[model samples]
Target chain A: MTFVAATGRAFLVLLEATGALAIFTASALSHSVRPPFYPRLILRQMVDIGYYSLPVVGLTALFTGMVLALQSYTGFARFQAEGAIATVVVLSVTRELGPVLGGLMVAGRIGAAMAAEIGTMRVTEQVDALTTLSTNPFKYLVAPRLIAGLTMLPLLVLVADVIGVFGGFLIGVYRLDFNPASYISRTWEYLEAVDVISGLVKAAVFGFLIALMGCYHGYRSRGGAQGVGTATTNSVVSASVLILVTNYLITGIFFSTK
Target chain B: MPDSTPSQPAATPKIRLRGVRKSFGPKHVLNGVDLDVGTGESLVIIGGSGTGKSVLLKCILGLLEPDGGRIEIDGEDTTHLRPRDRERVMRKFGMLFQGGALFDSLQVWENVAFGLIQGERMGRREAKDIALRKLAQVGLGKEVAELFPAELSGGMQKRVSLARSIATEPEIIFFDEPTTGLDPIMSDVINDLIVKCVRDLGATAVSITHDMASARKIADRIAMIHQGRIVWQGHASEIDRSGNAMVDQFVHGRADGPIQMEILHP
Candidate 1:
């Protein structure tokens, strides 16, 4: 009976969390469409989430690509398929590594920042002040962030994909003994449009999840400084996990064969 | 100084809360709160920390929903207002929060103009003009307007918050623990500014504070809350002579009385 009760409680907690997240997402998206849109706030958020996050995301993508190229050369050489290194590097970077790694990096940077900021605002009664001033916090705070996340992640991922492929190219030419021209051509040959598009779609979804989790946790935070810290941690963890889960689900949808 | 009686039978109260209840899980914050503030009256709710005074104010402001009760603003039921209606109703309100609650990202003038620009859709230039005027009214200099909230001193931040709250010229204003962390002299200064601002605008003011000096200075009527209920209410002058033990204990900051601090036993 105790075992059943514990399972039931766990299921209920999961259900409640999902329900709350769904409601928050719905409200935020609806507010984004509504009138009295705050263009300046949206632009500011775009810069914060997208532009400011570029260096970290770009660096992560570059390193990941380089390591992937080196690792693939080592493995494929054993199979007497060293020439396939460029194709492997490009395909893996575009299809999986670029979006996933970049999303995780941003989940750490932007997600934590958003949660900390909004949570501090929550504790300080700034959010309540916004309400009193006739501003719906969903519209004023959440919508701009959600919109920025949804739009900016794809752009970031696209850049990450290019940088990541470039990283692979440098490794294949300089580190490995592959001809630079043929290595570049090989990367282009196997790289279908679907590979890049699917990654970008996943990037967009990951972005939305990151922003949603941050705003949701932060907005609900209480108990002051400790609460803000907890919210920041929760936002990054939840966003990173959601990005991985959604990546698999999205990959299955785009690539699964009957 | 005319004492504004708590809801005269002849006039409709500007704000009214009856049997308002709020709780967080097992702990009941507001068991049942009942109060009324007359139009253009400055009503200060006096209570110790965690007595649901802030919760009561939030409920009335529609920032928190009451579990069970009716809240009426201007004789209209507002307990369960929709988001659109809530926003519409909120247009009539302005609030000065404890801890200043100034937007740290914005310049002092921008913080003051936030309501005007965002809420009323006023042009930036016009809002800036009003913001500068409001800042001046709060005794802050023109140079102070360009500085951010972090750059300002605590007193200056509070002054900026005051400017922001009144920027929209709201019909009703709320000051939540207006002098909680201020020095005695600064607290008195804030109390005076609040009194003057409320008087000049002829606006209905609701303030919650544990600061006796602030309550005495600003309140036309004072209500004391204990354990989520208003224990004693009367004109500010009557507070000293009110025979209620709870009110006496709280007003005098006494450790021994009907109201006992909940200290854990070893």
Candidate 2:
């Protein structure tokens, strides 16, 4: 690509991102302030998006943490720094991997599903029927997903944190032959409440991104079957990309050494 | 018999659209369209494929906002109602979707009761009772009520859609392509059911379709939409004397007429 063409493309992408962010901000504000709120709707979304999602998210987190420990043990053992294993696992989960990986997994699972469901509704005019029936599509459709996502992802990450730390614990206790008490103590010694809070904050933001991307693309989808499929693809891809990008930015804000 | 829809009181047009224009990029769908549907009247709008009949119906329903125009229902302007207000207006309507649009996650009874339970906030027991009653009105037995939409045949699904549309007993109902793809006999059966149920409720009916037979059987009056505008309209019998070439060509289903189909080749 030529310089000018690439620069123009980059600028266009930034503009698109800014527009999307603006829409997300507006909807979030609308959702929080809007009356006629349905507590039942929020609960239902929580059950659907959070409870039903537990098994898959659980499995992903358990394996990721175990693998992270195993990989770190091997890398640090070469430098005779294996005692730093707990520190490495805790920092990685708290700072980078937990929210990013959790968001990506849910993006693949929840984001694609949301887009497909909403996109199908859009195509079949169910969305219009909802509109005519005196229901806000944003409040009825988008809000539940956003609130569900904002809340559900944190719960998912909390589970991932436990299972992930446990996975590291199991590896350290059994395979690495590190003292279990020492490893546990090391994991908590320097772990401020800020670390856990930062991870959770990232989780909530990632959840919001997943739903925003999914709903925006799905609601705006045109054409027919092919269009729904494209919307689903875009939802997952954009959500996953945004999760990773936001993870870095958030990590810089929370844990920068200066 | 000009049976005034008693519910609307005949004081105002049930629906009015003035100079409504809609376009997608360069292709204009509705252009300076002006039309009115009388209270309690069954007005069937017939046009060929891509003639913007569906778009016009959607605009009236507030499903698609017209780029320029006013839409008033019962003398109250609805052209600029917010999402919530539009929904309130929508609650006054019932729609029989072209594809039935039943919720697959819900059972037949639940699909019918969706508006009652979800939109109207009716209790489940009452909603189901009303759903079953409406289902029976559409000739669907209670045995089919518990089944999901996927488990039913196309005819049964269409019947379920009809049942759902009338469940709330709204003042106005819109049917989009009521008999688009059903077999001839089945189509006639659905048409008859539509007439019977509509007359039973005394609801004002507006339907958009290309099915001349279906339109003839159900419409008390007929409006022919052509090129995003109403070309000729009159009583069902008067369609024969509309004298407008476009209306004649459409009623006769002729390819040779003032209307031209733009076939695009990529």
Candidate 3:
């Protein structure tokens, strides 16, 4: 009886949390489209989310691409197919690793920061202060973040795609003793416009999810320093997990065999 | 026992509450709070810690929704306004939170001008001019206006928050623990500034504080809350001899009283 009751209680809690998140997402999106928009705030958030995240995302993409080239060369050498290394590196980086890895890196950096900043504001009553001053908390805080994340992540991922492919090119030409022009030509041959576009679409969704999780957790956080800490941790964990899950779903939608 | 009847006549008090109730999942924070504050009056709520004084204030401010009862402001039923309507209604109010609650991200002048620019849609230059004047009224200088809230002392932050609250010349103002975390001199300074600002704006003021000195300094009438209910209320002059045990114990800060502390001994 106790086990069944506990299981039921846990299920109910999950349902409640999901419902709350859905409502919050609806409110945030509605407010973002409404008037009294804060262009200055949105611009500031864009700079923070997109410009600041470039270095980490760029570095991670570079290393991942380099490693992919070296590993693919080794594996394909066994099959006497070492010549396929450049195509493999370019396709894998553009199709999956670029958006996924960049999103995760940004989730750790920007998601955690947003949660911590807003959580501190909540604990200190700044959000209530906004309400008292006739400013909606959603418009002032969440909308800008949502707008920035939705628009900026795709741009970041686009840059990452370029950097990642370049890393692969460097390894294929210098380290593997491949013909530089041939490797470059091979990378472009297999790359379709759909590949980059799909990754960018995924980036946009991941960005929204990251911002939504951070804002939702921070906006409702209580207790104090401890609460803010918990919110920050939750923001990162939830964003990373959601990125991976949605990556698979989006990939299936884009490339599933009929 | 003292009567909870407001000093003002019953006809359309500036703010009125009847049986307003709010509760957490298992604990009732505000149980049937009834009170009134007349126009241009300074009414202070006094209570021990955890007696729902702040919760009652938040409910009246529409920051928290009551589970039951009505809250009327200027004879308008503001209990369940839509978000847009609520923002319209909120334009009449300005509040000083306990910790100053200034936007740490904004400069002191920008904090003061927030309502003017955002709420009223005033131009930046005009708002800045008004903000500087308001800051001066709070005894802060132009040099201080350019600095952030974090750089200011606690008293200065409170003053800046006060300036921000009154920048719009709101019809009603609320001060939550206006003198908490201040030295006696600073507390007295804040109390005096609150009095001056309220008088200048001729605004109806509602303040919640456990500090007896602060309550006496700024309040025209005083109400005491115990266990989420208003126990006794009367003119501030009659507080010392209200003949209500709860008010007496709280006012005198006595350890022995009908209201017992919920501390656990080690």
Looking at model 1, the pairs that clash are none
TM-score of each: 0.97, 0.92, 0.98
Using DockQ, give the best candidate's number: 3
What is the C-alpha lDDT profile of model 1 across A21-116, one tens digit per residue?
889888888888998888989999999989999999999989988998999888998999988888888889888998999999999999999999
Candidate 3 ranges with C-alpha deviation above 4 Å: B1-10
Instruction: Considering only chain B, report the TM-score of each candidate against the true chain B.
Output: 0.98, 0.94, 0.96
Give the candidate number with the greatest lDDT. Answer: 3
Score candidate 1 by DockQ.
0.85
TM-score of chain A of 2: 0.90
Model 1, residue B234: distance off in Å is: 1.1
Candidate 1 wrong stretches, greater than 4 Å: A1-5, B7-9
- Greater lDDT among 2 and 3 belongs to 3
Q: Is the docking of candidate 2 incorrect, acceptable, medium or high quality?
A: medium
- List model 1 lDDT by residue over B145-259, tens digit each: 9998999889889989999999999999999999988899999889889988888899999999999988999999999998999988998999999999989888899999998
Candidate 2 Cα misplacement greater than 4 A, ranges: A1-21, A32-35, A38-41, B1-11, B263-266
Model 1 chain B lDDT-worst window of ten: B1-10
Per-residue lDDT over B1-266 for candidate 3, one digit per residue giving the tens place of the 0 to 100 score: 12235655656789989999999999999989888888888999999889999999899899999999999999988989999889988999999999999999999999999999999999999999999999999999999999999999999999999999999999999999999999999999999999999999999899999999999999989999999999999989999999998898998899988988988979
